[model samples]
Target: MLKRRTRDFHQLSPVANALFHVIAASLAIIAVFPFLFVLIISFTDENTLARNGYRLIPEKWSVDAYHYIFQTGDSLLRSYGVTLFVTIVGTLISLCIITLYAYAISRKSFKYRGFFSFIAFFTMLFNGGLVPTYIVVTQLLDMKDSIWALIMPMAVNAFYIMIMRTFFSTMVPDAIIESGRIDGAGEFQTFIRLVLPLSLPGIATIALFSTLGYWNDWFNALLYIDNPDLVPLQSMLMRIENSMQFILQNSNNASLSSGILQNMPQDTSRMAMVVLATGPIILAYPFFQRYFVQGLTIGAVKE
Candidate 1:
C-alpha cells in the first residue's frame, strides 16, 4: 500500500500546475519576443524606423534591405555554397572523430583508454597559442586561402568528445556489446551495426553542436583565408556589415555624395543579416528536438 501510494508523490497539484504553465508560457514569450521584433524591424522602412524608433507595427514596410543583400546574387550564392560545404563536411568529420574517440574511452576493455582520455581532457584545459596554431595551419599544413581553412580548424572539439563519452558510459549497456561479440561480430562490425543504431540521440546532439560551430565560424576565415572566393556566408555578411559601418562613420566626408548616404538602408540591413544568419539553423532545431532533449538529460545524469 505504501509503495502504491508513493506513485502520486511527484504529481503536481492543480494550482501549482496552472502556475507552472503560466510561468513557462511567459518565459517562452520573453525569450522569443526579441527575435520576432528583429524580424519585424528588418521589414520596416529605414526612414520610418529612424523617425519613430522601434515598433511592433511600422508605419511603412520595405524589402530594400533584402534587395541590398541580394544585389550581387552570384556572389551571395557562391558564399552560400562555400558555407554549406564547410558546415556539412566539418560536422560529419567532427561526429566521426568524436564518437570513435569517445566510444574507445568509454569501454573498460580498451587497455590504453585512460591514457587517450587524459589526452582528450588535457586539450580542454590548454591549447597552443594563436601564433603557433596560425603557423601550423599556414606554414606547416599549407591550408592558407583555402576552404579547408574554415572546416579543419573546427573539425574537433574536446568538450564535445567529453559529452559523448559521458553519454556512452552512462546510457549504453555492456550486455549489448557482449551479445554482439557472442554472435561472432568483430569490434568494428559490432560498433557500426549494433552500437551506432542505439546511439542516435547522442550522435544527433554532437552533430547539432558541430553544425552550429562550423556555420557560425568566421574567425578562421578571417585568419587564414585571403581569397575572396573562399569566404563563407558569415564572413561575407560580416564584410558587408563592416563596409556599411565605415560608410556611415564617414558620411560627412566631402567625397561621399549625400544621396548615397540618404538612400542606404542601414538599420533594416542589420536586422536582415540576423534573420538570414539564423533562419536555417532555427529550422534545423526541430529535426533534432526529440533526440537532443533526451541526449542532454540522459548524458548529464550519472549512475
Candidate 2:
C-alpha cells in the first residue's frame, strides 16, 4: 500500500511540473514578443511595412532604412559621439559628488548631518516645479542651448546618495577607519584609499544608473537645444519620430517632392532609428548588470 501511494505521488509530480513549465514559457514569450517584433520590423522592407504593418518574419528584408541613416553618416556619428561624451562625463561627475556627499553624511562626527539629510530628503518630496526650474536653468544659469544644460541640472540625485550612505555605514567597519587614522592617513586619503575600494559595488551601481539616465535623457535637449549639431541620440530619435509622423500625415505636402517622398520608408525608418539609438545601451548592459545587482543587494541591507 505504501509503495502504491508513493508511485501515485511521483506520477502526479511530473504532471504538476509540466503545467508550471507551460505557464513560465507563456510568460517569457509575452515579455519577449515586443522586442522580437521591433527587431523584425527594423529589417522589413518599406513597401511591406507600409502595406501590412509588423510581422514576426519580414516578407522582404532590406537594409535601405539603415543605409539612409548611415548615409547621413557624420550627423548620426556626431550625435553618437555627443551622447557617449555626455554619458561618460556626467556619470563621473555625479559619482564623485554623490560619493563625497554620502561619505560626509555617513561620518558619525559630522555635526550637521541630520540637517543636511533633512534638506536632501525634502527636495525628493517637493520641488519648485518645471517653470521655476526652467527659469533657473535658462535665465539664471544661462545653460540654454548648451551641453552643460544636459549635464548640470541633474548631476546629483539625492536618493542615490542616501543609498550609498547607508551602504557605507553598514558595510564599512569602524575599526578599519580607526586603523587608517592611526597610520596617519588624512580624511580624504582614508576615503580615497580605503572607503572607495571597499565601496566598489555601490559606486559601480550608481555610475551605471547615472550613465543610463544621461544616455536616455531627451527633455533637457528638447527644452534648451536649438542647434541641430548639439542634439544627443535620444533627442535625434525623437526628431526622427516626429519627422516620420509629419511625412505620414502630410503625404501630399509638396515639400516632400515626388521621387523622394515615394521612396522614403517612414515606418521602417522609425523602427530602424529606434534600434540604432538604443542599441549601444542594450549591448553594454550585460557587462554592468552583475555590478548593479551586487550594489543593490549590498546597499539594501541597513546597518
Candidate 3:
C-alpha cells in the first residue's frame, strides 16, 4: 500500500502546527464564550445577579428563568411551529428562485442574460423602501397578517443570487450543458437533473443562507403579521422581554408593588429565552456544515 503524500508547502512543521492549533483554539473560545456566559447567567439566580453582578459561578443557582419562559407552554409551542414552518418553506422556495435566476444569468446562450443580470444588480443597489414595500404587501397584495407575509417579503435575496451566479458561471462547465442537450435533455431537464446535483455546494450554501435568514427574521412578522397565530418565535420572545422590562420599569411607581417586582425573573428569563430561541437553529447548522466552506470557495478566484 502506498502512503498518501501531502504537499510540502501545505504541510506545517511541528512547532507551526502547534501554533496554528493554539490560534484556532483561541478563536473558537472567543466565539463560544459569550454563548457560554449567557447560558451560565440564565441559571444564575436573579438575586445573585443583582447583588454580585455577572459571574461565571453564581452564589446561587435556579431554573426560574427557564420556568418563566416555559410557563406559557402552548404559546411557546405554537410560535415554535410557526417559525419552523416559515423557515423550512421559505428556505426551499428562496433557494429555487435564487438558483434559477443565477443559472439563467450564468448561461452565455441566454439572449437577455445581461438585462436580467442588470435587474438583479439594480435590486441589490436600490429598493422600493419599507413604506412602499409594506403598502405593496399589505394594501396592494392584501397578504397582510398571512403566513405569506413572513415568507414572501424576504423570499429573494439579491446578494445570494449573485453568489449563486458566480458559482454557476465559473464552476459549471459549458461542455456538460451542451452534452446534455446532445443527449435529448431540454434546458429545464438538464438544469434540474445535471446542473443542480453538480452545484450542490452552491445550492447548500444558498440553503444555509436562506435558512438562517428566515429563521432569524422577526421584523417581517412585526411589520405585516397582526394575527397571534402567525407570530414567529423571535417576535414572541421579544414581546416577553418587553413585558418584563415594562413591569420592572414601573415596579417602583406608587401604583405598583415592589414585592411582585422582586419576584419576577427578568434578566435570567430573558437569557433563557435567548437560549431557547437560538438552540434549535444552532443545532440545524450541522446539516449545512459540510458544504458551507466548499461552496464559498468554489469559483471565488475565477477569471
**Please, what is the TM-score per model?**
0.90, 0.81, 0.90
Write model 3 residue lDDT over 96-158, tens digit each, in one string. 899999999999999999999999999988999999999999999899899999998889999
lDDT of each: 0.88, 0.83, 0.88
lDDT of 2 by residue, 157-177 (tens): 999989999989987888768
Select the stronger candidate by TM-score from 1 and 2.
1
* Regions more than 4 Å wrong, model 2: 1-36, 50-53, 71-73, 290-303
Provide the lDDT at 273 for model 2.
83
In the order shown, what is each candidate's alpha-carbon RMSD? 3.1, 5.8, 3.6
The backbone clash count of each candidate, in order, is 0, 0, 0
Model 1 bad stretches (over 4 Å): 1-20, 293-303
| lDDT (C-alpha) at residue 181 in model 3 | 97
Ranking by TM-score: 1, 3, 2
RMSD of 2: 5.8
Count of clashing pairs, candidate 1: 0
